[model samples]
Target: MPNYIETDYKTDPAFFRSYIKPDLWEDSNALYKEYMSWENNKFFVQVIKQFDKPLLRQIKNIWNYMGIRPKEWRCNFFRVLPGGNLPLHKDTMSKISVVIPLTNMTGELYFEDGTEVLYHNMTIINTQVPHGVKPPTEERIVFHMGIHDTYFEEVKIGHNS
Candidate 1:
């Protein structure tokens, strides 16, 4: 199967942009300490907690529309600083992620198979695959939802429509 699949579902990037603030973000290395060894515990990436109920509701609605039902709700804002890149690695906690680029999303999403995606509206990415981000000209932020307990095949079928 493909490493990633684009979805028709789209949301207002402005809504997410409103929450962006320097103080709101926390170093991703601190949040996922277990994965620190993979990247030498670098602090290039940061994350913001998802707190807005309405935003969560909207994400849930989109999940439903895409025929995906997560066992639990987990959402966060992932920011990769300019000149920083996430080393190629597979996620252990979740197999799939719904990524919606919020700002300066010109970075490349590289997969182990040599496929690359430069721009995307909304996409479902296979986190189980070895993938990483290439440094971008500017900071990049994406709304990420980690989906568990749902088969990727089923989600792919929904997107195929």
Candidate 2:
């Protein structure tokens, strides 16, 4: 399968703004790194606590667009500082993961095959493979969601074990 696939949702500035805490976007705080977590690297934000009705509605739409009807899911708000890069790793936390960028930054998402995505929109990344991100000039913020993947079941039981 492909490493990533761009979703049908176009970038929505208003929707993005509605979910981001006003304090985190302040110029003075933009450079700071802040995130919530489920596991060591499974960073996430509780939607019910950090979002309103409208944002929740939009998130539901996003879940539908991705064809994910999960009984449970978690959201991550990543506030990446300037020149901050995540190490190469596989997302073992979930079978499927999606990344939706909220800010435009100059950076690259690199895969093991040497393919790099320079621009950001709504992209679904196959977390089973090795992948990583390069730091950008400006702070990068992205919303990441983890969902169940049946395909991962067999792989995890056989190859990963």
Give the top-scoring candidate (TM-score). 1
Model 2, range 77-118, lDDT digits (tens) per residue?
Answer: 665567656656676556666677888856687888888886
Q: What are the models' TM-scores?
A: 0.83, 0.70
- Give the range where candidate 2 is weakest over 10 consecutive residues by summed lDDT: 152-161
RMSD of each: 2.8, 7.6
Provide the overall lDDT of each model, using Cα atoms, as 2-decimal numbers.
Answer: 0.73, 0.60
Cα misplacement distance, residue 59 of candidate 2 (Å): 1.9
* lDDT of candidate 1 at residue 147, scale 0 to 100: 75
Give per-residue CA lDDT, model 1, range 24-143, as digits (tens). 677666666564465432233334454678776787777877677777646777787776667677877777888889986767999988988886678888888888887777878887
